[model samples]
Target: MAEILFPALFVLLALGVPVAFAMAISVFVALSFGSSYPSLVVVKEMFTGLDSFPLLAVPFFILAAEIMTGGAVTLAILRLAQSLVGHLKGGLGHANVLSSAMFAGISGSALADAAGPGSMMIKMMEKGGYDRPYAGALTMASAVVGPIIPPSITMIIYAMQDQHVSVGSLFMAGVLPGLLITGLVMAANARVSHLRGYVSGEAMPPLAEILRIAVYAVPALLLILLIVGGIRFGIFTPTEASVIAVFYALVVGMFVYRSLRIRDLPAIILRAALVAGAVLLILGAARAFAWVLIIEGLPQFLAQTIISWDLSPIVFLLAVNLLLLVFGLFMDPLPGVMILVPILAPISLALGIDPNHFAILVIVNLTFGLCTPPVGSLIFVVASTANLRPSALIREMPPFFLALAAALLLITFVPVLSTWLPGVSGF
Candidate 1:
């Protein structure tokens, strides 16, 4: 089945089928032609994949992001970020990076960040005399931080796959590395802005005005603390925290922000449902796909082959990083996580790598793929939102790509960056 499974999957992908359908169809093909197993096993495995209680968090978190966007919480975050960094060199660029970090706490998805606030930042940067492609590129690069920060949808899915780390620990573990990625992207922006002679047109707001903006944004900002702090202190489970996130987004959007209306909710709910449905379908397909791999003993075979190499933990990590980087270029992070974690994680455990550290490394590596070509979802989102060509954005990506690779290497080498916060928070 492995023979038919992989080739059929690649052929479907090359023909431009969506990843979910590609995986599902490949599973059907593999079963029908390559094995005696009934094709009904595909449906069974997909349903089994979606059966977990923790999987309930996926839709709630997604809906919370949609509500926050509808309610104008995203605008408040943009204002807060602009005030803080809009006066710096390459001011709008800096604000773009900062706002992504802030929004990551709320959205938890890179495509969400890129499509919502990231689009807005690109327009603002163009108005401020920055090149359009550069703005789009920066937006795409910075938006990868979405899943690296706490309350991440990726982390939620990841925790379900690997038992050694809980959702809360992954949430806490993501903070420093997310910020590290943000900082590197910002530094890249600063260098590019200097070379291009981009300067700030907006002066720093008065202290009183900045204070007012911060206070206005407080309710939205507190959602992050509420979710993370609540989970860390055992006040709520991550699943419960997701539910609270939706309610909190609702209250903040409709009443506090006054941007969301009662009449607006149905559309918001429908949109969130569509997005969540897509995500869940991918997970279901990935499950059936992984079931094929497991049944064929692909994971055990690869694990044993890698283990027999007698690699050190550090060497094993470098090798995994290279494999994931190439893998990411062809796959989105979510499905990548579902398929690869099951194979790579046990190998890392046997190598004595810390689970939290290995988890973050896989995540950060795959998230980078969202900005790469051929299958880079964030690249398309940013390109479509900003009316820029993907080639233009890709051409402008070298500096930011180097910046992200540097950060990945740092996370790969410095285990503490991914583990420290979780450790201190008692995870």
Candidate 2:
């Protein structure tokens, strides 16, 4: 299985097979050629992967994000972000970063963030005198916060993979780091804006108007507090919180905002269903792929070998960071989490690293991949949404990439950044 599975997986990926299909087919090929086990095991493992109560949050959260987008909650948040930051130097760029952070609270998926609010911000920034590719790159970079913040789909999947970290714990753990990444991206935007002579064209809004916008945006923003607070206080489980989020978003979009209509739900549901289906497919395939590795005892083999190296915790974490960064260059975070968490998480635990800390570090590292070249999904989403070439976006990515790398290092070396909130919150 070891000999046949990895090679087949690589070859298929090199052939441009989708990650989900590639993993599933690799499992089928490995089972048939390298073991007496029937191919039925592959199907069984894939189905088994999707069998969890907590997993229900995946689609519900996705639907909530879709509903919010269709209902104009996203636009409200963007307005609030703009009112707060749009008066600063490089105003539109700051607004882009701020909106991505605010939107990340509602939309757990990075691609959704990039396509929805991110696309809008790109257009706004370009109109405000920023370069098109630069705006797209900033949007792509800032949107990585979607998965690092609370209500994260990646963290949900990650919590499922590693039991030591609960959804609530991970949610609390993510707050500061998410803010850290947001600040770093904003700083990068400031530097670029300075160099390019990007200046604010609009004056700061009057206090009364800022207050009104905040008041209007509060309902949408409360959804974040609702989810995180509900889970932290045990008012609801993360799965239940997700369901409540859908209803809450519906009410806010329809009643308060009057942006959502009954007629609009079908299309929203279809889009959410498609996104959810794709995510689950990758998870299922990754399960089968990881199952093949477990059967081959590769995890144990590698764990034993690494444990024998007598590496310090700091050294081990730095090494894992490097490995994950490289791995992320090729894979999306979801599948990357599914396949690698089972292998690397146990090793981190053995090294006495805190689970929540390790989990956030891995998650943050993989999200960077979403904005990276070769397989950066956010790059493509932003590019297509903004009508810019991917190469153009990539060319503008270095400063933002350096910022993200700096954030990753902070999360890696300073476990306190990831663990403290969870600890204080009683997670």
Candidate 3:
């Protein structure tokens, strides 16, 4: 049954069926003939899968991201980042990375960053005489930070699936690694800029000028703080924080920035609903699949299989990283986390690895998948926005991939990098 389920799903995905549909079909097939499980039980399990309060956090966080994107916040971050970095060689590329790091706080979804920032930055870079494919490739590369920073939708999904892992802790765990990636991007941009003879703006902006823009950007920054701080301080859970985030962004966009209008609300809600619905369906289906795997002792089977090789923790982590990277190549972040986390949770725990650390590692692994070949959503988004081929982006992306791989290795061995801040908060 297990063999049939995964292979059929992959075959369907290979044929270019939508991932959610592929998962649903696979689940149905698994229930029908793979095991002795009743079809009715599968249906019941699917419903129960979504019966989680924390799961509500997914849509609200996604909505907050949408609202923030539609508001002045996106422009303000871009402006501030440009002021700071737009004077250096390949300055615009560096600006893209900085803007993504800043916007990661505001809009937690990488897809949002890729579409919004990638569109604006790619055009600006082209106008500045940077190669279109280069601009597009850079945008796709930096957008990876979106899910690795605070307020991430992926972190919310991780929390919903694993009760023992706190959303707040996962959020904290992402901060340092996210910053490291940003730095790596900036370094790469410097090299590319120097080699390509990229030039900064005619005049460097004054520090006071940069500070003024940052001041105006206070509202968006506050929204991120409100959500993350509220969660860590126990003022609210992830779900409550998400609700607050929506209203906060709405008020800021309307009253403070005046960028959001009444008409925009309907569109925002509709778009958010579409994204939320897709995510929830995937979550529900993955949950059902997870239940079946556990019932059939899949985790134990996997653990025993790994033990048969008599590997070390380093070997095990490396193998898991490779596995996740492959899974990420074919699917989006949420589905990969939903289906695989449960299966590996027991194994990771038995190896004395922190589950929170493991969750961060898994997400980071999956994050790279979004930039890989075939179905990498970020790759596709950046390519389309820049009118470049995925193959083109692939070439420009390998250096950043090296940086990301190095960061992954650091986080894998240095669990304290992921755990210290969360532990300090007593989460």
Residue-level lDDT of model 2, residues 1-427, one tens digit each, is 8899989988998898999999999999999999999999988999999999999999999999898875368778888999998988998999989988988898987898898888888888878888999999999999999999888999999999998999999999999999999999999999999998999988899999999999998988898999999999999999999999999999989899999899999999999999999999999999999998888999888899999998899999999999989998888898899888988899999989999999999999999998887878887788889998999999999999899989998998889999999999999
Of candidate 3, the 10-residue stretch with the lowest lDDT total is: 284-293
lDDT of 1 by residue, 64-182 (tens): 99999853687898999999999999999999999999999999999998988898999999999999999999999999999999889999999999999999999999999999999
lDDT of 3 at 388: 83
TM-score of each: 0.99, 0.98, 0.95
C-alpha RMSD by candidate, in order? 0.8, 1.0, 1.7
Off by over 4 Å in 3: 36-42, 307-310
Candidates sorted by TM-score, descending order?
Answer: 1, 2, 3
TM-score of 2: 0.98
Score residue 322 of candidate 3 by CA lDDT.
88
For model 3, how does the per-residue alpha-carbon lDDT over 111-189 read when each residue is reduced to its tens digit? 8888986688888888998888778878887888899999888888887767778889999888888887788878877
